[model samples]
Target: MANSLSDRSSGGHQAPKNKKYQMKREALEQVIDKHISNIEKHSKKLPGTFDKEDIHDLRVNYKKVRAFLRLLQLEKDAGDLHISDKLKSLYHHCGTVRDWQLFLEELHDVGIVDQLPDCMHRWHRQVFTYKEQTVHAIETTHFKKLLHGIIKELPRQLQEDTVKQFMHQKIAAIHILLLAAENEKDLHSIRKQIKDIIYCIRIFKSDWGIPFPFRGWKSEKELNEMASSLGDFNDQCLAISLLQPSYICKCDYKEQHILRNLQINWLHQKEARQRQLLYEVQELHVEHAF
Candidate 1:
């Protein structure tokens, strides 16, 4: 999968010559340029620094770029311009490291680290090794080429449309999905859909004067807050899963027992949080009458 960003410029692609679509095309190109630059900056530093925040930021930028590409694809037939899978693999490479980092932080916050220092230390070493391998996979010529290609081709793929109408259509689809979502997994998917719509709005709204469609149910702030809550619920689920005996076999019997107990408690907490979040999502959907 592609990892590092290449220095290949967008090949000096100019905005559409047609005056009617000039501003819209420029807005699209600007959004693509900004994200490509950000992704490149962070991806280049990955091999040298291997910082957790860098990994996170790179993934975020990748998502932004992917979301922008998705918008283009939705607007027009962007054949051979879809780079979601390659970017997704790159994101997952860093995601493993991120998940472990978050898991470690959760352990520390819940006092598990202090109680089972030896076990935590051993797990930390394993996580470090995994991160090294992931980084190694990322810092390659193929990865660089992939990043370069996406940035180089994106501007050419964007087509002009009424920004406000497009935004309304996309957000409305996401709202329908949110209204139909019934469980934690569904809620998680809804959060991602909402995130994509937010990215779309952010890019278009940067240079175009388009107002958001939803009134009480959707705003950048509201969507972000909802996604954050869902993120916490997801982290708890992952933490409990990682605490399973099969995964933490290095732990002694006493440590294993402690982990099992912690897992059980977290499971209960996750259930409650999931329930509350689902209710909140339902309420928002109703208020919006999607």
Candidate 2:
């Protein structure tokens, strides 16, 4: 699976503190710092590769650095220094790419290429071309340079308050986004928004504590698992989005029936899980003494 997403911690255990934790944090930060340095060196000679790797590293380290800074802010623990938003946007870029990559992988998996009618096959190919064009646009611009500059300046920007503030803001944004989505009857959109919201929650959990508010919820582990399941459902929705309209049109009655069956099954599962999560999120708000 030639995935660019690399697990910096190979042991698959919670990152421990002490000498071992300190060593890993320092080493990972150095890896990030060196990646920035490499981007600067190659920016003039090469272009896309630096941007690509820089974005990947930024996403990889987002939770790590966020956790490190949160500990420093909330607990007086020692951790790596923070980076700038310009550097942070680099992570955002990789995120956009990753979402699309997931989309493409979905289309491929659902046998989209083979499912389309012969007459519409050419149009389906064009849809793939559209996806590729969006990707290339990001790779060709000064977007990469901007991300690199942020990376270069990151170590100096490490601050406890900054990371904590950002986390709070993200939580607020998720709440607001969900409220807006609840008005629409599109389960697809609701599921997508929930996925993003819960993903933000997971990022916070993986960095800080599972229950997110730390003081709330007995089933932090269960909440995390629910988010993971919802995310899988969102992935399927994204896959559906990527597939060409023509491909869908070409499906015979039986093929369409099968597709609908697959979709309905997923939606049923997604709704059940999301209801449980909704209750949990509300409970957290109450726990915060809201």
Candidate 3:
């Protein structure tokens, strides 16, 4: 991946002469627009496949497509990124069911289902209801029809000059936000913003073989280490938030107690990973400042 990124970066010098670069950019935008269109047109078919595994796969696809579209919009502004943000919120909410489902599956896999609360078993039964609601919301014809109206107007909005201007504005805004994130709440927000940037880089890296912007901006190994740390912290945070005491209150059996201990261990490991990453991120920023 790094080698390909290097080759592509070098190849761009010769690309100014080729219409292929322009065409590819256009094609990329069109493909993204088409996918958005598909979601808008067929969202009503969403709820039938709301199972845990299926929802997890859908979440992955949604993240990739949403990330790709946002990156493309940064460079091309053909679609409304706010729409993508809304979709991400919905996706995150929908993830609660999948997370719980995984938690239960792992418990069963380890042969500890009997250790959990009777209430947890009951909650697991209703997981499908939450899943179905999320799917239904995403698939609603009304929502898609509203999005279709805005998205279909893309080609005109995505002029190269406009996209360039849009990117400049966005980069500047994110930079300011990064600089202003001082408190824990601010840092939390910055982490989300940076994660989105990383997501975009990963998507572009896979799709176009481009060097990630962060690569040019900092030490590759250090940045990666920090990113890994941030990811661990975020995952822990998500797990903690999703596992309500209501879930735990029901998990009070001795073996069920063991499962809770495992969760605590997981949280500790995640925190340790995050602290290491956070220190590294700060160190790099200080070094860069000089």
Candidate 4:
């Protein structure tokens, strides 16, 4: 995942014949069970505050489940997909907690905790409130039972040929997006696409060392770096957006003075990151074209 295992090539998705390539039903079932266990283990109603890393891992498992399901392209309106509505509900609820926690962490990283004690206190308490909602959401989710129903609907196996074709389509679409990207919002879209690819690739790695089907389609490591950069900017914007109004209603003169001093510096950093992301998006070449 760090670098392309296969040498770069154009216009093909074929894997070597001797390689083990199919996603067998048994393997898929095993992966689902493992992910379900991980979700339960991490979300187990712990007595103290949940560590940020644990929350992150829990959300990742949920993404893995959804990404694999999407890779299969199972349909709902006309076909055989029965992903639970509760699963989506739980994912979103957990996300609410993560957002508040991240905003708090970002503040600490920037040394704002001591400078803005009242603001920090409000956000810290807000994280607990969101976590309470997540706990209730977790209690209501029965992923084990839900996944059992899903496994029953799955096919006997998914061939590598089908998987490669889907990946090719995704790569080609990413190229189009790269060519068309014009702003920070477009870069955000690109980040989502990279994450989807990474999640699907990781699913295979969790079972077998399934070789990624395409070369020059940026390695997982490279995609992660880009995603990380985009995420930092996104988080900064969201934190400031949410915190501004809450602090604005205050009559505290000192808080107002501190924010006024920091606002320009923050805006400049955000703009610089935006431009860098745009350049990364524009760097794709013919080899990256599937």
Whole-model Cα lDDT per candidate?
0.64, 0.44, 0.51, 0.67
Cα lDDT of model 2 overall?
0.44
Runs of candidate 1 exceeding 4 Å displacement: 1-27, 84-86, 141-144, 151-180, 205-219, 285-290
Instruction: Flag clash pairs in model 3.
Output: 43-139, 44-139
TM-score of 1: 0.78
Please give the ranking of all candidate structures by lDDT, highest first, separated by commas.
Answer: 4, 1, 3, 2
Q: Among these predicted structures, which one has the highest lDDT?
A: 4
lDDT of 4 by residue, 1-290 (tens): 11122221223344565564555567666766778678778888432667777778888988787777766653222126556887777777777777777766776777866877666566567777777878887788886788777777766565655566666766777777887787777877777776777787776554455546555454556767776887777777766665564654462677666765666667787788778778876764324444
TM-scores for every candidate against the unseen true structure: 0.78, 0.44, 0.61, 0.82
lDDT by residue for model 3 (171-211), tens: 45546655644433444554554555556555445544543
**Model 4 pairs in collision:** none
Which candidate number maximizes TM-score?
Answer: 4
Local accuracy of candidate 2 as per-residue lDDT tens digits, 1-290: 11111332343444322212122233324445544554334333323333445544445445444444443333234433455555455445555555655654554565654554552454446545643553454345454554444344333322324334444544464456556443223334433433443443444344323223222224546545544654565555554543444445565665565556556665666567556555544443312211
Write one digit per residue (lDDT tens) for candidate 1, span 176-256.
776677677787777776677666656544424333333335345776777778777777777787887777677877888
Clash count for each candidate, listed in order shown: 2, 1, 2, 0
